[model samples]
Target chain A: MLLSNLELVPGRRVVKHLGLVQGSTVRAKHVGKDLFAGLKNIIGGELKAYTELLKESREEAVERMVKQAESAGANAVLNIRFATSSITQGAAEILAYGTAVTLE
Target chain B: MDLILQNFDLLLFAVLFITGYVAGRWNERRHYASIRKREDEFAGILVFTNRFPPPSTTRVATVLVSGSAVISEDFFKGVVAGLYSFFGGRIRSYESLLDRARREAVLRMKEQARAQGAGMIINVKFQTFAIGGRRASSVKGVEMLAYGTALSPVGA
Candidate 1:
């Protein structure tokens, strides 16, 4: 399915608006990774592990969102947006939301 | 020798402080240099925050592109930020950290657009999170994510 974080896809016209669809997931860091991050705080640089973790979480969220859009019979998701919130000390929630629409 | 052994905690703090300062500065310099170089290389791909793509007669396909970067605060910057909080003044050290994270994220997004043969990206959005920062004191790092729609020519 085509995904665009814009009101209208460049060359595609929306024939139907299936309403809003959203997907979210809460993820917690592993204890081992948490300990590694603590040590990484000392020298201050890129945290590849954390980066990868967040990336995976976001992709999962987007995947779920796409599934929802597909179930709604939408050919594409438009005006997509993402949100991240720390739900607790070591956990965060990643959210993806957009308007599901059929394009022509 | 006796004094050093007696004040081992203080000695260790001193050693950590020096190492953090030195290494953090070096890393920041290198990162900025690389960012600048990449920025120059990717200058052809324009990025805009407007929600609408520019008018074009040629058919273009819009696709979602995104990039994220996670940067951790060094020991020295964290200490300095702590003191700055106490003083109620701007934390200059963290300014650079956030700057680097944002630029790096954008660069990654641009790289993806370039790979897809897109010359411009529009409707850009940014989301930032403080990882492990449930408490004010334990903000280990910041994560920056940039996302947008990339318009690539359908047939070239």
Candidate 2:
């Protein structure tokens, strides 16, 4: 399905508004990475652990959002957005939302 | 009698130490899992957006996170304890959630633009807010919002 951050897709036309669709998830990874990250802190470089962790979570969140949109029978999702929250010290939550719409 | 008392004290100390260690490790794992889940979800949604086009007209979208949605009791407690950590403790988690929500909202807008036969989205904006107050039995919610204008491509 087509997804965009803007109200409307630049090249397509919205024919109908299906409704609002969204997906969210919470995740946590092993703390060994955190310790490794701490050691890397001294070197002042990128934390590969966090980077991999972030990438994984992002994919999961999007999968959920797309599923929601698909359930709504929307050919496209408009005005898509993402959000994150830490329910705890090491855990994080990611949310994706958009307006499900049919395009012509 | 003195030896017996010392033994009892040692046993108590061991139990307490074990409990603390387990609790600490559990808490850390919980946090890591939540973070990873969120990150994966966000990345998946972005891939969809990148494959799509931007919007052409103004539109708004929002996503929300509620306390009831959290399953981990310890994580919930951590949120409560976080209040005392000068808000930094839980801020990272909240930020990640909000970021994912915002990105998804933008993607939705782009979808709208494509539907409208627009070329690009313009004037995008985001907003966030707390909808519920802290309560022992109540769930708090955070909302993520995005808005923008969809543009049509030239000579299309």
Candidate 3:
């Protein structure tokens, strides 16, 4: 399915609008990664563990969103956006939301 | 008990402060150098607003690109930040932390765009997530995300 933040697809015409759909997931860091991050913190560059954590979280969120759109009988999702919130110590929530649509 | 406790805490802070200053400084310099170099190389690709589409493009594809960076605050910066808060002024140490994370995210997005053969990226936006923060777990770090829709000529 096509996903975009833009309201309209460039080459396709919007045939129908299927309302808003969303998917979200929460994740946390483990002891191993925590130790790694602690060591990396001193060096002050990109933390790969956390980067992978967030990336996986975002992907899962988007995957769920796609599932929702598919079940809704929609061919595309538009105006998709993401949000993150700290749910607890070591854990974060990632949310992906968008309007489901049918385009031709 | 009180005297021993005090000494131990000071010792811990001293170690952390020195480690943070040295390692953080080195990392910052290295990242800045890399970011600058890559930005220059990727300058030709277009990154802009989503309001307009390239006129010559026959077919358009929308792609999602994002970069994530987690920066941890060192013991030294933490102490300074704690004290600096009372004065209500900018904490310079945290500034570079945030800067590095943001730049790293943007560069990742640009790299993704390049890999997809996209000439430009539009609707670029940034999102910041505190991994371990106040009211949550005590891990001091941030996750910066830069994402956008990449546009490339489909027919070409």
Output the number of the lDDT-best candidate.
1
Worst 10 contiguous positions by lDDT, candidate 2 chain A: A38-47
Worst 10 residues of 3 chain B by lDDT: B130-139
RMSD of candidates 1 onward, in order: 1.5, 12.7, 2.5
lDDT agreement with native, every candidate: 0.90, 0.52, 0.82
Q: What stretches of model 3 exceed 4 Å from their correct place? A: B1-6, B54-58, B135-137
Model 3 C-alpha lDDT per residue in residues A1-104, reported as the tens digit of each score: 98888788788999999999999998877999888777665555677778888899899999999999999999999888999987767778899999999999
Superposed Cα deviation of residue B147, candidate 1 (Å) = 0.5
Alpha carbon deviation, residue B48, candidate 3 (Å): 1.7
- What TM-score does chain B alone reach in each candidate, compared with the true chain B? 0.94, 0.45, 0.85
Per-residue lDDT over A15-101 for candidate 2, one digit per residue giving the tens place of the 0 to 100 score: 999888888888775767656543332222224455455446756877788898898888888777777666765666777788999
Tens digit of lDDT per residue, candidate 3, span B57-99? 6788887776677777665666677789889899997888798
Residue B122 alpha-carbon offset, candidate 2, angstroms: 6.1
lDDT of 2 at B78: 35
Q: Of the candidates numbered 1 and 3, which has the greater TM-score value?
A: 1
